[model samples]
Target: MKISRTIHMTNSGRKHKTNKIKSIYNNMLAEFKRGEIGYSTIAILGQSCLGSIAVILLLMNDMPTMIKMVQLFLVTVFCMAFNGAVLAQLKSKITFDLLIATILLSACVIVTNLV
Candidate 1:
């Protein structure tokens, strides 16, 4: 009986945690869709995601540092294109500051690695 009770509690606890995570994810998605978060925030976050993937790809290829930088730059540009398109679809204007910030960040990454 005690073993069965422990199993049931564990199952319920797992379900509770899963539901909580799902709720949080849904809320965040809703906010992004609603434009509650500004474009810069969204772009940075999107770029970060793409950048991580690019890093993983670069690692797997065992490429040179220069090549890795170039790949990262390309990934950053692709992320910008995607974010721009999404903002455009929502009729949101892309600002110069956001563009410059992302470009500078990408450049910094490449330049720092070159040193």
Candidate 2:
């Protein structure tokens, strides 16, 4: 039936989109590993600044104490992980991945605080 055909087409389209995103992500990771996209110093500083800002925002927010503590713990863990990556001199890809994750997590926290 036309409805079944449409559903199948939609599923196919979703798969295609997902594959495209994955391909793009992989390409970016490759480029980062090759030292073509990010700098270690900048990423380190960014992680530090963003982490501090996230902590400040979390503390200033009117959220419940338990929720605040949980978010703070996550932020601290992420920051520490990034620091550990630098201290351990891990590969560029791993360090960059952690930096990106830290930035994203901090951005989420900041946005949540503002909104």
Would you estimate the TM-scores of all the predictions? 0.34, 0.72
Residues 1-115, candidate 1: write the lDDT tens digits: 3445343334644534458777775675555556644755766676666456545655566558787767666666755665675566543333433444555555555445444
| Candidate 1 displacement at residue 89 in angstroms | 1.0
Window of ten residues with lowest summed lDDT in model 1 = 91-100
Error of 1 at 82 (Å): 3.4
lDDT of 2 by residue, 20-58 (tens): 777887887777777633466667777899999999989
Candidate 1 — which residues are off by over 4 angstroms? 1-19, 36-63, 90-115
- Checking candidate 2 for backbone clashes, the offending pairs are none
**Number of the top candidate by TM-score?**
2
Instruction: Please give the TM-score that candidate 1 achieves against the real structure.
Output: 0.34
Error of 2 at 59 (Å): 0.7
> What TM value does model 2 have?
0.72
RMSD, each candidate, Å? 10.7, 7.9
